[model samples]
Target: MDEHYEKETFLLRIQAINKTFLENHQRAINIIAAMVAIIGFHVYAGFAIAHDFHKALPLFVLMLMTYAGLLYFLLVKQWLKKLEPILQLTADVFSRIWNFTLFDISICKVISVIIILAAFLVWIIIDSANSRIRLRSVGGMAMFLFFAFICSANPSKIKWRPVICAVLLQFIVGVIVLRWPAGNEAFRWFSEQVVTFLNYAMIGTAQTYGFASSPPEICGFSAVFIFSSLQIIIYFGAVVGVLYYLGIIEAILSRIAWLMQYTVGTTAAESLNAAACIFLGQTEAAILIEPALKTMTESEIHAVMAAGFACIAGSLFSAYIAFGACPTYLLSATVMSASVSLAMSKLLYPEIQESRQKDIGSFKFATSKFSVIVSIH
Candidate 1:
């Protein structure tokens, strides 16, 4: 009986070892496959660029350096550990400088005003050199100022820091997208890629309808519009669902939310919702901060609502593209409006009461249940 028990234990141990070895072997195979695929892609790209070697040489070198840096950071732990003390010392020095305040608040405000005015003057000069000033430009500036003055619940309580920063951010983005050639080209390329990607929904639409021929026109518009809209929604919904499951959406929104919270002095919930409004519909964005909604102050609620009204939903990108809207302009407008909406909301309904949820770390994003594929449906 003892011999029989011993034999069973020995067999179990051998099976466990075999299972572990197989798992490790599979991992090794996967790693080798990935490396080979990457190398093959690089080789194909190299062949394609051989004709334009002179032009693509710098890019190739940069790519190599980037890969090298990534590998070094990922694979070399000892080097990172050796540099830890130096990194800590550098951080400490920067922290001390950041915490040091050399001037009084009133004096700092005056200095900031002077710097902003000077920067505005420089921007105007540069912009004038690029293109002639138009009536629309002046009108737009007037409209912004007029709205702020007209909407203020308490003019004295309004915070100008966020308002000024938001306006400056808009102007800077406009300069990049409109004034700079390289930046404009980059945005244009990105916009084209986005439109192309969204166009893929048409494939699913066609497949589902089993269309032998294009549909008849309705009210001078193709009936494809209806099908396209539904298909795009279904397609992008699944894409967003996958992104959410992989934490990509959360990772991106968190950084933007943190930036807004730091720069705009808004509560975590408000900033997060504002950031989310850039990619999601108002209802979906609000759902992200659902837990904090009931406890939110009136100003915070106003900001959230304003963001929803100001921004466009990501799902409708294809619809607008089909209508001949410039994708780059649409994307830029949504991004700029996020900060502007927050500023405008604050101006209209200034927050007098303290917020309960000030830190972004305290708010939890709503997650979908079950598998990602199941949630998409």
Candidate 2:
């Protein structure tokens, strides 16, 4: 009887531990929910102030709302483990097409960016119907037709329920943040001070380790110090520690993944690309999604690589913009790469997919020893 009682106690303890383990992610969920409330209020208030402007360009505002949430969610990459099953289902539908002709990621990167940017540029220059519009109507129609053609080439798995819930949550959060003056200020502070700082650190690391440098115009200040390995090491080390402490790095990327899953089509695991952008840059993003590489249809891989080519991480954004590379060019390039990746992967590897939550967040940052070797030549 004593033994039996002891076993019962042990079982109860195990059950209690399991409950706590599951509850760990609840805090993240609540924070996201609060963010949703904040943003939702903001979006509504924007509409209340000027309904016509909001209605005329709801897509732009919608894009902004998505960006706001993505910026916040990116801070919580670690907690994404709990969100995989759901994310997999949400992202599956957005996978783009696979083009057989594009042989390698390196070249496909250029092709895909050109295609996406060209399309966007054409739309801007041309008018749709020419009602007090200065642009050409034929060009606008051609660009629209081109996107339709591309999307038609690749099919996707549609799971609208999750998409609906996610979008509504995002919109609601926007409104709430907007309605509460205090919340708006807080969110803005987080973006300006927290997010920008984190992104800058990533930029510095990529240049140091990835071997890319900002153009002279962009690197006026950073260019001087970036030349020193010692300085970079210290700067990067500080970035890692501070990011880890504030949890901002994970939060921002996670939100980006969430937004991509909703807007683009892919699995939650696909956010490996975004996560990679933060630290590893583009090819590094591939490593995080390594498991899916074999399973990913060909088109998806191309998009992944192309996104790396098109968009430098947040760190590189300021540099490119400063250099007159065109910020929209970079942003749209990444977006198009992701879009095309899904389509291409589908054509290459056509199989019903399972989720891969295990590979990505288990990232281990192993520090290496650096020994100075100086020889006179």
Candidate 3:
């Protein structure tokens, strides 16, 4: 019994390897190899052409080859429109068991891919090669596509606030920059100076880590580089702090609340809190106008959820940008998410009934204390 199990396991492992070998990696490999060959040849041609036309003589041939290959494959050729999606619906349905567990479907797909790789290799070789090949049409693709369509039509729940906020932030920043270019220039310079400072700080950090051997890499403009990294976060924090202190947030909430009651179809208080939530983090934003929650309707609660779903935080932006995100895109997404949160919230709860008024409650100023502690410690 032990020997039989070991033999079976070894057979399965060999089967897995054979499947991987036959599965088409040619599409990817061909593109990569062609790119490397073309680039190397182009670079060599650049240097070699300076002295002799004999070497540069190949340029016409290369151009002809490129154009001819492109024309033949892209425009003139028509060999296979019979290409069908490898993954289709019956297997998906069998895997998903009706969306109770999405991960189960994922597992099914992974397993299916492996099984199909092996199955098709045998099918293809038998159908096409010299020994004995038989080709037959199968009715699998249609069923697979049906399931893929269903999955696409109904995606799993997404926490939308971050997406919304990132978009909105970008739009707001872009408009502000474009509307007053001169003012923006100064702002840009100030930002750059801070970045420059952060750059120097990074240099200091590098020196501490034994990355720098000289002082100049830690001095002057390099400090500005370090400052730039730090300043983006600090500046936004300062702005939010100052705004909260001056009750600008409350005013914005009031206007948003009014808009929701009249045009957008949200309860007055729900819109107010929702708007405030846009400027604040999910939980903290809820506290800005807290008294209304107990009596808040389900739709109102959903609106709040929607708002939370759309907006993003200032705290996460540095980490996001560090990962090579475009700043404009990141900022804009935040702002748009906020807007969509409002729009979507309204969609989920239209304002046809009587509107309710809620008080503009006060939020304690912990922000100032936090800032002070940060500055001091």
Candidate 4:
């Protein structure tokens, strides 16, 4: 009788949870649809008015602001108030099954979200005023979002929080890197350091393989040897291994993953893997979170894979630089691609189920002799 009663209670609880999920999901859908409608109308109005777009901008912004205020006051605010308890309940249930803890939505989170949105809106307004906003770019963005929505595993349950945050961060970073003089100078300095380092490696390479030369006694203008310059990655890999053993890599990854967790709404493992993918190869990044791989949810796996495909490792930057690509551009692209990967991954495979991976504090892979050998090799 006790077992039967427990089973019955479990089923009832599941049904109730499912019912709440569906309700919240429907509300989210409605809100998204309304937002889409507003954007569509704004786009249409811009096109219809033509030259008047600039003149009517403030009025249009005011109207949209009013609508947004109404939407929040009339529906979203109340929904969020009720949503807090539901999210907490779901998190409790999820923690029991999953290795990682889920964050319950709080007033601070809500305020942070609002601030981010406000900043983005302000940027958009300023850019538009400066005539920097382009229709073609907007169209491309819309197309990408549409593609992501179509490819999503559970379109109805597609979470937009991570996708939006990732995209905004990417754009903001791009603007900073491209438009700011300090950023440009930093990239130049880094490139020069990389070149100097590669040149130093040539001393060792020339001793082993001889100086890069043309036929007969002719000397080539470029001293870079494909095999020699590329071998620098092996040295870099060794340094990374030592750093991992010292917990430096883990500490850096932890801080980066923490920012990513809030911005991207991902588990620590997923966030760490994505951030690691910026500097390391896909397989290498996975090794950073090796213990969590087998236990991760399907969505988490997709995120890892997606980030890998989207970003290139720093190891290949020297090889690409030798191939005539600008070093600064390559570095910037590598950094930007991290955000793009996260956005694209969430779009391609939105997380519907809670992740099963745990938030591990530290990772040590270079402890054993064999592990050190592998890292060096």
Candidate 5:
């Protein structure tokens, strides 16, 4: 009787383990299915309406709204609590694959280096074929390499993985923006829309300051930079405050930070601040990871500052647009700079000490004590 009872207990435990595994497998399948459905619908709708801009605009807006609604539900309403876990799992798998190293075989190292060089040579050939190999392009490449060589903190200890990935990513972005017609048009259209939207602030300024018909020109420009800057700051501050209150900003930032941390091998504080710098001012970006500041290594702090200097804040987009800057170029440069800055920073100030905050989700974002309105103020 005792032997029989023990067998039954062991069998029961096995069954429970199998049941849990099956449940988790099912959950993963369901999440994948939902993502596929959403993407399929988007692709179908895009292909169907892509030919007509006037007809497609409403549908595009609707699609964006749908995505926003789903994001709100998942993040704000806490629907599907396992969503973050699933995302983390996917990110982990990719990160592992990306950072995986071969055995320390000389032949393997030689092959890897050859492959990288060949790919880079092909890229250069393609670029030169499409556009004349200008002195500016050659000079830029030389300067970048020179900077990396001269500023490296620990020349022998520098990790090339993140730096190489970053440069490749920047190159890919440039190719998409400059070489692809569709991408170029998309960016141009988006830039035009941004300029048009920011122009509304000028209308308000005209109404408030009585500069409607004949506005005071600054440096031969019709738009007053000060008024537009003030309006945009207040507008964005309130919007960001509300989004932060709803946890949307945090959720978005966390995912981006995680991606950068894993892919670029930066510490959590560095990655988080880098992501924040894309949208926020340098000071504001630093404040996002304020708690981690004290514990951050010199390399991490340098990365944060470098990213801040590299990226243009979203609030400043209006000022540049008012100044007749090509918004598409500005946006592209900002995006590319973020990656290059991290690569350069790592080279300049190689992390010597072990990082305290390694996990992307380890750091707590700074919270506001006041209500959203007061926080905005």
Candidate 6:
């Protein structure tokens, strides 16, 4: 009887643990939902205020909103720490169930299949709506496939779901940015703000370097003057560091990663790094996922590297703008590159090993590491 009683107690304990784990996971998800609500409110308020008041929102007000958002995100990240153990326990429980063999369908697989179908529907709808189907578009897709196949280290190991998701994502984003009026306007507004702010920083730059350093009137935009704009990269990097420290970037990136993971079966680190690469530089994004870097497979490493080569950082956006690139196009390309980079990497180095989620919290931001190491004799 004592043995039976002990067995009952053990089962009860397991149930209790599982319940707590699920509850904690739900709480974390709720917190993320609240954050999304707040983001929606802010975006709506910005648009409403701008349209109704017929005035651009004060930069200070935007700064305050960003600050508040960052604080909220930081608080949530701390709260998530309390749930990590529960999350791990939940994962452990799920892992134990893998041997049951009762069911074959996995949530990730189901979701990926659904996404594939939805993506196809979207493509068909768009194509049908278009005035004409261009042969060049078909040719371009063939070339992309051919490139992916040739670059793949092991063609047989390629994961089709992620590759398809990546291609569809890139297509959707490209069409929105390059074709949609509303999308163009929104990006244009953002680009204008970025340009205005960067130009404003030129005042401080001129003050520090002296206005006479290279008078554009005389030099006609000398290389020295053009290169001086690189100083803005430092200021932007500092601001980004603060944002990352506050957990705003992680919060936003994680949610994006969640969606991507659901659709493409990407691991948390890959999704987060991909999202982070959109805003931060490749080096910074790599640092953000450094904790998982060592454990990552060749495919994951390739994804990070591809993202870096494909997209420029937010800091460099202003520099590119100064170089006469269309701000909207540059922004569009970087955003699109986030997904394309992943697709390209997955094509070249298909993931043979299953990926596991990793903790994604604030990391040490060390810009000094970006500099080339040299040992002078």
Comparing 2 and 6 on lDDT, the stronger one: 6
lDDT of 6 by residue, 95-164 (tens): 6664334366566556656887787767756776765455467568769878888978999998777887
TM-score, per-candidate, Cα-based: 0.74, 0.37, 0.35, 0.62, 0.71, 0.65
Task: Give me the candidate number with maximum TM-score.
Answer: 1
Query: Which lDDT tens digits does candidate 2 get at residues 177-261?
Result: 5556775655554334433443555566666655444334553545443543334344544454455445555555565676656
- lDDT (tens digit, per residue) of candidate 5 on 262-281: 77777788888888887776
lDDT of 1: 0.80
Top-lDDT candidate index: 1
Query: How far in Å is the alpha carbon of 78 misplaced in model 3?
Result: 76
Show where candidate 6 strays beyond 4 Å: 1-55, 58-133, 212-214, 219-227, 354-377
- Model 3 over residues 136-246: C-alpha lDDT tens digits? 322343343334334432224322332233233433455566456774664455444433433443455555534332235533523343334454445555566666666
lDDT (Cα, 0-100) at 206 in candidate 5: 65
Q: Which stretches of candidate 4 lie over 4 Å from their true place?
A: 1-115, 118-122, 128-135, 212-226, 358-377
Clashing residue pairs, candidate 6? none
Q: Candidates 1 and 6: which is better by TM-score?
A: 1
Higher-TM-score candidate of 1 and 4: 1
Candidate with more favorable, higher TM-score: 3 or 5: 5
- The TM-score of candidate 6 is 0.65
The candidates, ranked best first by lDDT, are 1, 5, 6, 4, 3, 2
Runs of candidate 1 with Cα error greater than 4 angstroms are: 1-104, 129-136, 212-221, 372-377
Candidate 3, residue 360: Cα displacement in angstroms equals: 7.3
Q: Which regions in candidate 2 have their CA more than 4 angstroms from the true location?
A: 1-248, 272-280, 290-299, 325-377
Residue 279, candidate 6: Cα error in Å is 1.1
What C-alpha lDDT values do all the predictions have?
0.80, 0.51, 0.53, 0.73, 0.78, 0.75
Name the 10 consecutive residues with the lowest summed lDDT in model 3.
153-162
